[model samples]
Target: MNLKKLLVLVLVMHSDAGIAQNLDTPSIKETSGYTLANLSIDSQITMFYYTDITPAVHFYGDILGLEKTLDWSWVVFFQTGSSSFIGLVTEGHDAFHDVQPSNAVMLSLVTNDLDLWYERLRQWNEVTFLKSISDSGPIRSFMVEDPGGYTVEFFQWLTPTE
Candidate 1:
């Protein structure tokens, strides 16, 4: 009846009870009687509506260096990452008809080379610089506006201090 033996016995008993409970309980698909076969969520796509998609395509694909994945005339999808995409939809064509650029939402792009990005973006005359590259806080970042007026923040995370 040592303390360590008692603790081990208690843990084993608890684990057994948990396993028994899990075996008895029905899964969501069984209890709800609804299979998730209809819904297969994988990637994420942020859609921005614009009156004309040319400028958006130029800014996202050409300037930002995002690869153009799909083009549907009304909507053009740019691959941001392996599973993330930014879609520019022609206004009045898709689900959004009366939508306008609010410039409220800020899309952040994390990078390892902040200085290189800053230098490149600074040279682009079409980019509206919102903030200069500053490493004052936890994140070293610079904000700029896209052709569709979306605030794009390029940032690099600073190493945590001991």
Candidate 2:
């Protein structure tokens, strides 16, 4: 048998030689520091900057139906019922960001209502297609451009996440 399969069989049999290695090394917290390693992260947000944030806000909030968690004159935060968030920010004096609108960021939304979202967004005037709805064995998905020119994808897992 191959080395990997043999090792797997040996481990399955609980052989002494197959015991896990015991290494004495500094913990990951040592490098990252106690504060960061122990930080209670509530949400992860992918932010996009735009000269005009209104259209992007409507796309994510109105069309996608994500709940608004925070809103200000220059920024808005939306949550997808989890610790992950999406922030839309205006690229001007209020937020102190002067960067150009970026298309490098892609927002991926996982959902059970794939068809519902596809139908809803396809009807929106701001929707621009990047990819048509299609299946790839493990997932059914489609991609489109949001008002800010960022790629947005909606996907449904054909099978439960492994």
Candidate 3:
């Protein structure tokens, strides 16, 4: 089976939320034996891009210990959980640049301790902290630009009692 078909089968089987009526379903063309599916992702998936050469794969693999689902061309997919994935794509690559690429998208991360990441990132020479811990009402978070200009955020939500 082709990669497209394989992806469809995997998604269909592992879909956390049942397919709703409004969802554009994947249809197979009879003659071609190929299916055309909308790349409409569920809410859990996130895609991030990098412009210059960076060790994103290493960071996700070695540091974060995420297994690669697919690594091809300028795109790399890392499986975060059973149903979630993290996408890393080369910014200048045709696949990504064909559409407008924006650095304005801030990746928000909910972690156990924001200070742990904030302290750890300080040891990395390549990473730059954009802001110290900032309060957003009930949450305390910090933003750091990674080696490839992608903002890696770490945050913790404050409880009402705390």
Candidate 4:
């Protein structure tokens, strides 16, 4: 190697952190170095199975103003973000996941216009507030109950995100 190249290599080798760990080891698990064979996710959709899908559809499409990607009798999809979607599904015997009395899922929407949303939601009689507008550490948020009894949260980051 040239003299300049050799000197630079020696300096990096003797850094304060000492020798770095070898990264050539084959990865086979779920942690760092894990590998997937050209797997790319296009988008994600979180679905809520409801006993009655009409009001749920109106809540997302009309109240929330999420543009519908697809609409049908059984299901409706709304684009919440560039790569995220929320779907409302009709509950029936033929449905993939049968509707239960209670659901554990909470749809959290991150937005910058938190106050504007809160004001808009307040004016609508259709929206029922589960939690009033409040602050929670790194975020300010509020929760609302949808027509299907799903908890939807709107939050805004208070501090800079990494």
Candidate 5:
């Protein structure tokens, strides 16, 4: 296998370590400071989705909604009904590959109305590659992206009416 092909294969198999590290960071808050002694070391899965947004991800702010919240270049924060929370941060925030923005990580979001979200996202010229919705086991999902080039997925998990 050629070097480029091998590299692509590796990337496909594993998520970027840089993104995992950024997600594990004690606190992503730039303005606020938190130390180890002051921080609660909780062992949990928190997804910090990132992208290579120019001008640093920190320059952005949060766009809060009823169920989801998107941070400027920083991250899109979401909490599942199970009480699990994830932060989607854009690239160029911490030290990673080159100081400039290039590529970050994949981010996902859940919505009750997948079609409505798709329609709204379509109206925005920035969004690209509107994938078709897929039904898998218990959920129907689709994907899209923001203007900054980060993949955003919308999913709706179905519950058996029984």
Candidate 6:
């Protein structure tokens, strides 16, 4: 079987076990005929460029309460969720050079406690509140701007009867 097939088989077996598997250390028998290269595309990390990372750190870490996983001076990584990370690259860095910040993309976060987040963020004078708490369709949401001028939306999904 090809590498992809082998990986699928292993994943299927683990899934059938009905237990959470540690992605850092996948259990695979050598007899399965799969190598490390076959599972190279393990996880993905999303990144955003910034002219300065200090504000990014303050916004994501201090304000949003995301854990700072890595700090590489020019590049910093924040743990956004399980197996998900957001990287901040400083301007003049190869990855951020010539790139302009745009409102075309917004980082959205879904939460069960929208009111709590709103209360907390409102207390911070640095937070730029674009929209107040409002219910629209099936979601209750609000918008804020980070120091980098990026729009961040916080929302909670409303139940059918709500």
**Tens digit of per-residue lDDT, candidate 3, span 30-72:** 5455433534556466787665324887776665556888888
Model 5, runs deviating above 4 Å: 1-104
Reference-based TM-score of each model? 0.72, 0.71, 0.58, 0.76, 0.42, 0.69
- State each model's CA lDDT, in order: 0.76, 0.75, 0.65, 0.81, 0.50, 0.75
lDDT of candidate model 4 versus the reference? 0.81
The pairs that clash in candidate 1 are: none
Q: After superposition, how far is residue 92 of candidate 6 from its true place, in Å?
A: 2.2
The candidate 2 region of ten consecutive residues with least summed lDDT is 16-25
Identify the superior model by TM-score, candidate 4 or candidate 5.
4
Over all chains combined, what TM-score does candidate 5 have?
A: 0.42
Q: lDDT tens digits, residues 1-162, model 5? A: 443563354445344453344444546445467533356635333454334543223212222122454444454555543555555555466524332254354444556887786676556454465577777545577766444544556777567467
Off by over 4 Å in 3: 1-43, 62-66, 80-82, 91-102
Q: Please report, as a residue range, the 10-residue window in candidate 4 with the lowest summed lDDT.
A: 21-30
Winner of 1 and 6 under TM-score = 1
Name the candidate that leads on lDDT.
Answer: 4
**Residue 128 miss distance in model 4 (angstroms):** 0.8
- In model 5, the Cα lDDT at residue 139 comes to 57
RMSD of each: 12.8, 9.8, 10.2, 13.8, 11.7, 9.5
Query: Can you list the residue pairs that collide in candidate 2?
Result: none
Q: What is the TM-score of candidate 6?
A: 0.69
Give the range of the ten consecutive residues with the poorest summed lDDT in model 5.
Answer: 55-64
Best by TM-score: 4
Ranking by TM-score: 4, 1, 2, 6, 3, 5
List pairs with backbone clashes in candidate 3: none
lDDT of 1 by residue, 1-162 (tens): 543563354455445355444444348557876555434569989887788889989998878888999999889999877898888888786546545747555676778988998888777888899889988446678889888888788877688699
The per-residue C-alpha lDDT of model 1 at residue 27 equals 85
